[model samples]
Target: MKISNETKVGALAIVGITLLILGFNFLKGNKLFSKSLVIYGTYENIEGLTASNPVIINGFQVGTVGKIEPDPDMRRIQVTFNINEDIRIPNNSIAVIAPNPLNITKVEIKLGNASDYLKNKDTINTVASEGLLDDVMKKVDPVLYQVNKSLGTLDSLISNVNSVVDQKAKRNISDLLANLNQVTASMVQSAASLQSMLAAETGSIAKTMNNVSSITGNMASNNAKISHVISNLDSATGKLAELDLQKTLNTLEGTIKELQAMTAKMNSGNGSIGLLLNDPSLYRNLASTGNKLNLLLDDIRMNPKRYLSISVFGKKKTAEPLMLPQPDTLNAPYIIVDKKNN
Candidate 1:
C-alpha cells in the first residue's frame, strides 16, 4: 500500500498528541484523559521540593503536587495540588511534604480522626516539613561548607608539612629507622634476664599458697568448736537475762536516786555532809582546831612529862597510870553535848 507524506505526518501527529494527553493525565494521577480534584496548601520553604512530586498520606501516594508559589506575605509557599477523588480526609488532619520516586519533594496528606470528615474540595492544615533529602542537605550543606574550608586549611598545612619533611627528614628517615631497630634488639636481649627472675619467683608463690591452705585447714577444723562456744554463750546470756535484773536495776536506781537526794540535801545544808560541804565556818573552825592540835602535839612531843603528869593541880606527887575518857550513853538525855564533840 502506497502512503502519502501528508498521511504519515498526520498519523504521527495523532500518536504524539495521544501520548501527550496520557502523560499529562498520568502526571495528574488520573486515567488517561480524565479529570481530577485540586487541593491547596501553604509552606514556609519548599527546600528543593517541586511539582509533579507524589502527594501521599502515611506513605500511600494519592496525588501529585501542582503549581507552587510564594504567598502574599512572602514568608510561606502557597502550594496547589491535584488529588484523586473519593478519598475523604478528616478536617483535623494535616498535610506533610514527602518525596517522589526520583527523590523529588512532594506533599503528603495526613488524616487524623475528627468529628466530621473533609469534603473533596476541603482545605487542609499546612504542616509542610522538609523532605528527607531537604533535611539531610540542610544538615549536610553547612558540614560540606565547613569541610571545604577545613580541606583548604589542611591543604595549606600539608604543603607546609611537605616543605618541612621533604627538605632534610627524608634523607635521615632510614637512619632513624635503623637506630630504632638497634634499640629494639638491645631491649629484647635485656628482657631475657627479667624473664629468668620471674620464673624463679614462681616457686616462692607456690610455697606461700601451700602455707595459706594449711592455715585454712586449721581454721576449718576449729569452726565447729567456735560455733559450740557461741551457742553456749547465747544460752548463758539468755539465763542471765532471766534473772531478777529488773529488781536489781530498780534497787540500783533507788540507791542512785537516794544518793542524789542526799547530795542535793548536802548542797542545801540538810545532812552531816551538809555541815562539811555548805558551812565555811565549820571548815574554818576545823582548820583552826587542827592547827591548835598540831601545836599541842608538838608541845607534848618536846615535853611529854608536862601533859603526862598524874598529880592533881600541877602538884606532882607520883607518876601513876592514866585512864582514857568513856563515851557518853545515848539514853542519858543525849548528855548535854560536850563542847569538844559539838
Candidate 2:
C-alpha cells in the first residue's frame, strides 16, 4: 500500500481530534452523545468545590456541577449543573456541591409542582444545605474561645484544691487511721472479758431456774402432807362447828344469876357466908395476932437457937403459955398498934 505523508498527517490529526471530542463528551457527562438535564443552585461558601463535580439527587448520581460563579446580587456563589432530561426534576428540586468524585456526599431536595418543567439552564432555587469542613470550623471559633476560658478557671480551682490537700491533711488522715486501729485493738482485747461476763450471767440465770425447779419439786413432793393437813383441819373445823358450846355458855350464864343471889345474901348477913362476911371483931383479933406473930418471927430471925433449937440429950426446950391480947373484955374496940414499939 502507497500512502503520502500529508495523508498520514491528516489521518493522524483527525484521529486525535476524535479522541479529544470523546474525552470532552465524557467529561461533560454525555454518554458518547446522549441527553441529560440541567439544574442550578447557589451557595454562600464554595470551599473546595469545583466544576465537573457530580450532582446527586438523594445519593444517586443524576448530573454534574458544571460552572461556579459569584452571583452579583446575592453575593453568593451560583452553581450550574447538567442533568438528564428523562429524569424529570420537579421545579422545587435543589442542586448541591458534593465532596467526592465517586458522588458520595449528597444534599436532598423535595420535588415541587412540575407541569412539563425544568429545561436547559433552568435555575432551581436551593431549599436546604449542608456545608463544607471550613464552614464548620468558622462556626466553631467562639465555642472554642468559651471552652478555653472555662478550662483556665477549672485548672486554677484544681491547683488550689491540690495545694490544700498537700501535707497536713495527709498527717491528719494518718492519725485518724491510727486512732481507728487502736480502737479496734482495744475492742479485740475486751472481747474475751465481755464473753466471760455474758457466760457468767447466763450461768446465773440457769442456776436461778434450777433453784426454782428444785423448789417446785419439793412442793410437789410435800403435796400429800399438805392435803393431809388440809383434811385434818377440815375435820377439826367440823368437830368445832358441831360442839354446841353456845348452849353450855348460856347454862353457865344462868348459874351466874344464882351465884349473884347468894352473894346478895352474904352482903345482907343472912347465912353462913353472911356471918363470916359480917364478923368485923374476928378480923380485928386475927389481924392483931398476925401482927404479934410477925414480931415474933423478926425476933426469931435475930436469935434462931432461942426459937428453933432443941437439946436432944435431955430435950431441954419447954412449952411456954403465951399471954394473948384480950380484945373481948375491952370496954372500947381498941385500935391495934404495931408491937414492934413494945
The lDDT of each candidate is: 0.75, 0.72
Quickly count the clashes in candidate 2: 4
Residues 41-81 of candidate 2 have per-residue lDDT tens digits of: 77786545666666666667777767778877856888777
Residue 243 in candidate 1, Cα distance off native in Å? 6.4
Pairs of residues clashing in candidate 2: 36-83, 36-84, 37-83, 37-84
Highest lDDT, which number? 1
How do the residues 1-342 of candidate 1 rate in per-residue lDDT, one tens digit apiece? 999999999999999999998898676565454456766777787667776777788778777777888968889887877776767777888887654446667666778888787665567787757556678899999999999999999999999988889646986997899999999999998899889998999999999999999999998999999899999999999999889999999999999999998888888997767998888667767766654555555555555677776655666544332222123322222122235744
Clashing pairs in 1: 43-77
Q: Once superposed on the true structure, which residue ranges of model 2 sit more than 4 Å away at CA?
A: 1-4, 42-45, 68-78, 98-117, 127-131, 138-342
* Model 1 alpha-carbon drift over 4 Å, by segment: 1-40, 43-55, 61-94, 97-106, 110-123, 127-151, 166-191, 236-251, 276-342
User: In model 2, where is the ten-residue run with the lowest total lDDT?
Assistant: 321-330
Per-candidate clash tally: 1, 4
